[model samples]
Each structure stands twice: as C-alpha cells, then as structure tokens.
Target chain A: MNNYERYMGMVKGEQVDYVPRIPILMHYAAKHIGASYADFAGDYNTLVKANIALAEDFGVSQLDIMSDPWRETADYGAEIEYLETTCPQCLKHPLEDSKDLSLLTRPEVGKTTRLTAAIKAIEAYKAYGYKEYSITGWVEGPAAEASDIRGVSNFMIDLIDDEEFACELMDLCVDVAIEFAKAQIAAGADTIGVGDAIASQMSADMYERLVFPREKRLVDGIHEAGGLVRLHICGNTNHILPVAASLGVDIIDCDWMVDVVKVRELFPKNTVIAGNLDPVEGIMESTPEKIHQNFIDLYHKVGNPYFVNAGCEVPMDTPKENLQALCKPIQYNSSI
Target chain B: MMDLKDLTEAIKTGNRTQATSLTQEALDADLTPQSILDAMVVGMDEIGDKFKRNEVFVPEMLIAARAMNESMAILEPSLVKSGYKPLATAVIGTVQGDLHDIGKNLVSMMWKGSALNVIDLGTNVTPDKFVAAIKEHDAKLVGLSALLTTTMPSMKATVEAIKSEELSDVKILIGGAPVTQSFADQIGADGYSPDAASAVDSAHQLLGIR
Candidate 1:
C-alpha cells in the first residue's frame, strides 16, 4: 500500500502494514528546499517545491502544507510583518480598536489574494499525489484565526469581558475557514489539516463555551466535503482533549504534554492520535539512543491505529540522525 | 477562610486576591517573613511542576506568577528588614533569532518571585549580549531561552562562549521548546529546565539555595 492508502486505511480503522509518520515539517521543509521562510509562506511555487522536497527527504507518508498563520488575518486586512528567518507575523489586529464584528467582511475563499494561492497550491499538489499518499490542505482553526484577526490579548479579555463579541468573531472566522476548507477539498485535497494551536491554551470551560462548537462545525464541514480532517493544536491540550475528541475530528495532532496513553483512553477506539513528543528536548537535544528509546516508549503507550510524530513541527536544527530514529519503526511488544 | 493552603491554592489557580489576603493573614498570625516567603515559593514551585507536567499552561502560570509577585511585593521588604538574603542572582534571556518572550518572561518573573535577583535580558539576545550581561551583572547563574529550533544553536554557542571566558565558574541554565537536559549536557550547560517553573527548582538546586 502507498503511504496515502496506509494512512487512510488506519484512519478508517483498517489494518495497516506499518505505522505512519506524519510529523509537521514546515521550516524544515523550507530548509530542505533551500528556500527562505519568506518565499515559502508568500509564494505557492516555493511552498510546493519545499513540501515535495520534504516528502521525499523525510519519507513522510502524507503531504500536509500550511502557509504560515498570517494568511487568514492578511485576508481580513491585518498588517502582516515578515521576518528574514521566521514565519510572517500579523502586525496589527484587524479588530483591534474596533470590536465591531458587524464591520468584518467575509472575504470570498477563492478570491482572497494569498489564500487563493494556497488553494491553487493544494490543487497542484493533489493532482500529482501517489495513490497511497494523502494530500493535506490546511486552514487556521477558529481560535487561532480569531486570535490573528482580533489579537490574542483582546480575545482572552473578550472571552470574559465581551462574550457576545467574541462569539461573533469566532463565527465569522469559522465561516471563512469552512469555505476555505471546502475550496481546498474541491481543489483535490483529500485531507484538511486544521491549525488551531491557540485553542489549546483556553480553559476547558471557555473552550466548551466559545471555541468547541466552531471547531466542531469546521470538522463537520470538512467531513461533509468528503475530506478527512486532522486537528493540530500545538500546546498542552490535556484539559480540552475530551472535548476535542468529541468534536469528531478524524485525527488529533497532539503536542508534547498530551500523553499518547491518555489520548488513547480519552478518544474512541478508532480515533487516531498523531503525536505528543517534546519536539525540542526529545528530538532536537537528545542523542540517537535517547530518541530511539523515546520512540519505543511512545509506541508502547500508543497501540494500534497510532501514527508516530512529534507534538509539533520538527525543529529546523533537529539532528538528522535523531529525526531518522523518530520516523524509523522500532519493534515493541504490544502487550504493555 | 484565609490560610496557607488557601494561599497556595490561590497561587496555583492564579487567584491574586486570595493569595494576597492569605499572605497578609499569615503575616498577621505572627508568621515569620521567611515562613511567608517559603510558602509563596512552595506554591509557585507547585505551579511550575504542574506546568512541566503539562497540567497547566502559560496564562495560568502568568496569573499565578503575578499573584505570587503581588504577594512578594508585600513580603520582600519584610524579608530584607529581618536580614533575609536571596538565594542567588540569575541572568536570563531568549537567544537570538527567537522573538518568543512569554516563556522567558514568565521564568524571569518566577525567579523574581522566588526571591532570586534576576536580570532579564529580554528576547532576541545575542551571544555577545549574554557574555556582556554576565560580565556586567557578575551573575552566578545564567539562564538562556530559545523558542525556535533554528535559534537553539545560538544557545549552544552562547554556552560555549561563556565556558571559554575567564569566569567559567558561572553556572549555565538552558530552556525553551528545543532545549533538553541532554542538550544541556551536550552544550556543557550546568542545568536545563523543561518549563519556566522547573527553571526555578533547577536554578535553586544548581545554586544549592534550597
């Protein structure tokens, strides 16, 4: 079976020949393709070249691509500040001085400048995917995209201080994301990766009230569009794991703190958990032996229908041998 | 209603009012300034542990640190008037190419609350900057943070430069998303903290403070 088939089969609860490795590799991919982070996020051809290079170099089973977190905010007319080495950042909040959700315009999914470029990239990548390799198109999740548009500090205070406005902003962001996800699916993306690293920081109560429904809607929308959904929340999402699982997302991409065993306990029998390894300490700092043992430990905790990956994107400076040990399968007794 | 457990719990949950009130109550009950400081440190340390275990996160940590700071503002002069000495002086910063200062800032605040004299170098600091800070502060403990993987090497290089300096006696601590204990040893750093809170314990242990 090709990598795509194996991943799909595992997600479908079918037996797979081996575990799949879907580590998030953005900066690393850009590094592999020898492209600047600027070009990688701004230009579609640069992103495509880097991603294709990443797939070949890392032997990753899936192609998941995201154009920095600024895409949605930029479309909403936020000022984006691009650095030489790092990902572009949103400079001004679109909803900063004015908390008026009514003034917010929902940009057409296919017409927004760079977002259209992202959709085009998805189309091009999906057109050439191997039968077994899954093609992933990405969109910022409601909380993350909301933070981009309405500033993180403002959103936090608004959650308690201006509840109605926060919900309205969330709804607007979700509508745009759903339409974007649908466009990506129509463009041939077989899977949609939702980048919602910000939502992981919310309290369980706030999450259930403000963020959960919008995430559920986005996941449901992707499923309705005939595409699989993978949710990437890159922080300690332990408190919201149960609610996150209940959102019915096909796959949950965890970061360092969400233990795989805990995820297995919380999620339904068939739900696939991608990762929870400390990207920096475990893979970037540790030796080959340490990395190998860490993987073995993870495998022991994560049983069948689990993919091997770090909690977040692999660091650009991650030792090559350490990364190899992470993706390379190791033998472990399943009875643990 | 206001007691030590309540105070610690307040600090843990980042409840500033309860923490401040309980701290005052503890002081009113003829508790020593050292006792209040110990309790505050213990509470902040517990918050740190929970953070390291991923049971808590930045917002909670920030509030708890803020609460502890508020209490510390009330307790510091008392500790000094009674002739209490801080454990040590620590200089901390985020290495170059990394703009993430939240974790670094939190750690610095926690250190300050723990009664350590912390000289914060802020974010996007360079090796020469660290060396200069070390020399200027005469700091015994130097803490470095790097949120980006690409900047982690700068952390290692900073450590290397410090070790090569005349005062190799300075204890070095490293953190951020990419730093690990193994990497700490690889770079010859004196300690590695998993999170901002753990940095407190590691700093204390490295300095033999507690």
Candidate 2:
C-alpha cells in the first residue's frame, strides 16, 4: 500500500504494511528546498514544494499546509509579518488593546488570503498525489486562534477575568475555522490538522468548560466535511488529554513531554498516537543508530495504529540521516 | 483589620482586588512593607510550587502573578520609602530569531515575584544586546530563552559572548521548549530550566540565592 493508504488504513484499524511517518516539517522542509521561510509561508507553491520534497526524502506521509498559525488569524484582520528565517509574526493583534467582539467578522473562506493559498496548495497535493498520499489542510483551533488575535497574555487574562468575552471570541474562531476547514476539504484535502497548542497550557477545568466544546464542534465540523482530524497540541498536555481524546479526532499528536505509555493508557488500542519523541534530544541531537533504535522502541511502546513523528515539528537543522532513521519502517504490532 | 494572611490568600486565589486591598490594609495597619511584600511573595511561591508540580498552569500562574503585581504596585512606594532593596538584578530575553515570549515573560514575572530585579529585554534579542544589557545593568544573573532549535546556536553564541566579556560573576540560565540540561552544559549556560516554574529555582541555584 502507498503512504496515503497506509495512513488511512491505520486510521481505519486495518493492517498497514508499515507505520507511516507524518512529522510536521515546515522550517526543515523549507531548508531542504533552500527556500527562505518567508517564501515557504507566503507562497503555496513553495510550501507545497518543500513539504513534497521532505516527503520524498524522509518518507513523510502527509503534504500539509503547516507553515504557520497566522493563516486563520489573517482572515480576522490581523497583520502578519513574514520573516526570512522564522515563522511569520502577527504584527498587530486585532484585539490586542481591547476585547471587542464587534471587531471580528468572519472572512469568506475562498477569498484571496493565506488560507486561499493553502486551498490552492491542497489542490496541487491532490493532483500530485495521483490518489495516493494524504493531503492535509490546517486551521488554528479555537483557543489558538483566539490567542493569535488577542495575544497570548491578553487572551489568558481574558480566559480568567472575562469568561463571557473569551467564550464569545473562541466561538467566533470556531465558526471561521469550520468554514475554512470545509473549504480546504472542498479543495481536495483528505485531512484537517487542528493546532490548539494554547490549550496545552490550560487548566483541565477551564479547557473542559470552555474550549473543549468549541474544539469538539470544529472537529465534528471537519468530520462532517469528510476530512480526517489530526489534533496537534505542542508542549505538555497531561491536563487536557482526556478531554482532547474525547473529541474523537482521528489522530492525537503527543508532544515529547507527554508520556506515550500514559497516553496509550488513555487511548484505545486502535487510536492513532503520532509521537512522544523530543525533537531536540531524541532526533536532532541523536545519532542515526540511536534515533533508529528510539523509533523502534517508541513503536513497540505505542503499539499499532501509530505514526512515526517528533512530538512537534521536526527541528530545522535535524540531520537528514537521523530523519532517515526516524522514518525507517517497523513491522506492525497489534496492541489489541 | 484583615491581616497579611488575607493578602496571601488573595494572591493565592488570584483575587487581584482583594490582593491589592489586603496589601494596602496591611500597610495601613502599620505592618512593615517588607513583611507585606513577604506575604505577597509567599503567595507567589505557593503558586510557583503548584505550577512546578502541574497543580496549576500558566493562566492560573498569570492571574496569581497579576494579583501579586497589583499588590506590589500598592506596596512598592512604601517599600521604597522604607529603603527596600531587591535580592539581585537580572537580565532576561528570548534569543534572536525567536519571537515567542510567553515563557520568557512568565520567567520574568516569577523572577520578579522571587524578589529579583528583572530587566526584560523582550523577544528576538541579539547576543550583543544581551551582553550590552548585562554590562549596562551590571546584572549578576541573566536568563536566555529560545523556543526554536534554530535560535539555539544563537543562545550558544550569547553564552560565549557573555563569557568572552569576562563577566564571571554574571550567571546565565537558559530555558525553553527545546532546551535541556545537556544543551545548557554544551552551550556553557550556568543552569537550565525545563519550565517557567522551575526557572526561578534554576536562577536561585545559579546565583547561590534562595
């Protein structure tokens, strides 16, 4: 089976020839193609070229529009500034100085914007896939999108002090994100990656009461749009793992800080857990042999329906040999 | 007639108004500014310890810190009038090519709560800027944060730059998502913190302070 089928089969609980690697590789992918990060996030052609190159090189399973988090925020009247060597920065948070819900109006999903570029990129992936590789479109989850527009500190304070405003803002974020996910699915994306890294830092009570329902709606919306869901939350998520898993997302990405063994305890045998490897120590700073061994051990520990990946995005300067070791195929083992 | 216990409880629960007013009440009751400050610090330390153990997360820590900050605003003028002095001065910033600063900002607030005088240099700070700030402030402690591995080399360069300046007394602490104790040792940082809560302990350990 091809990479796409392998991933889909894994998700569908069918036996795959081997586990598929789906490491989010934005900066590293751009570096592979010798393109500045500005070009990578700005032009969908560059974004697709880089992700495709990495997949060809490292046997990555998905072609994702994972350049940055500002795509959805851009549609919310935020001014994003692209840098040559780093992810684009949101120049001005639309709601930085205030919590005015009236300031937000949802953007038309297909209108010309960062997201438009992403949909075009998804179409390119579909054409290139020849109905094989999985094509991924991304959206900021409610909490992350709210953080992007309101600034992290401001949004955190809002979550504490003004629950009404925070929920309203997040509701709006989920609405825009659902329409954007649908547009991406219409553009031939087979998967929608929801990034809610902000939720990783939230209290279980706060996340459960406020963010989870909205995130559940977004995940449900994507599923309704006929797209698989990959939930990516960077950093330690020991607090909200249960609620996050209950969203019924197709895949849940575990960061390095998350104990995969513990994550396995929370998820069923058929659930797809992408990773729990430190991008720095486990892969980037490790030798090929050590990395190969690491992947082998993580695979066994995590059991079947697993994806080879770092806890987060592959670091920019990770050795190509180390990645080769990371993607080296391991025979499937059933946990059931 | 509410005592500093009420102030500590206020900060603990992140009740900013209560924290602020209780601190003022303590001062009005002829309680020493240092004692009132100590009460607020006790509240912060409780929150910090809870954060370290994962009992509380950033939002709660921030709210608690905000409570402490509002209380500090009321208590600061009195403390200055009473000739208060911070434990030591610190300089902190996110290394160049990294704009993410929530962790750095948290560390700064925690350091401030710990009674250290912190000068925040903000995000995307260059190595030369770090050295300049260290030299200018005569800071005895510095904290460097970098969320990106690409900026890690910049962190190493900053450490080397600071060392090259013969600032032996200036202890350097490094922390971020990608940083580790090994990375810290390799880059010659005096200490490393895995999270912001542990950052204060790392800084205190590096500087040989409580």
Tens digit of per-residue lDDT, candidate 2, span A1-336: 998899899999898888888887788988999999999999989998998898888788888888888887877788889999888988898899988778865666667477788888998998898457888888999999999999998899899899999999999989888988999899998889999988988789989999999999999999999999999898878879977768888888988889888888887666789997888778888899988788888888778778888888777888889888888887777653
Tens digit of per-residue lDDT, candidate 1, span A237-297: 7889888878888888878767778888888878888886778777877788888787777
Model 1 lDDT, residue A21, Cα: 84
Q: Tens-digit lDDT track for model 2 on B82-111? A: 998888999999998888888898899889
| Model 1: per-residue Cα lDDT over B1-210, one tens digit each | 335777778888878888888888887787888878877878888988887776666667777777888988887777889998766778899887676667788889888877788999977788898889889978889989986555778888899888878666689989876567777888889999987888888888888877
lDDT, residue B47, candidate 1? 83
Report clash pairs, candidate 2.
none
List runs of model 1 lying over 4 Å from the truth: A16-18, A93-108, A130-132, A150-166, A202-206, A276-301, A319-336, B1-57, B64-89, B147-152, B177-180, B204-210
Please list the C-alpha lDDT of all candidates, in the order they appear: 0.79, 0.87
**Candidate 1: lDDT over CA atoms?**
0.79
> Which 10 consecutive residues of model 2 chain A have the lowest summed lDDT?
A104-113
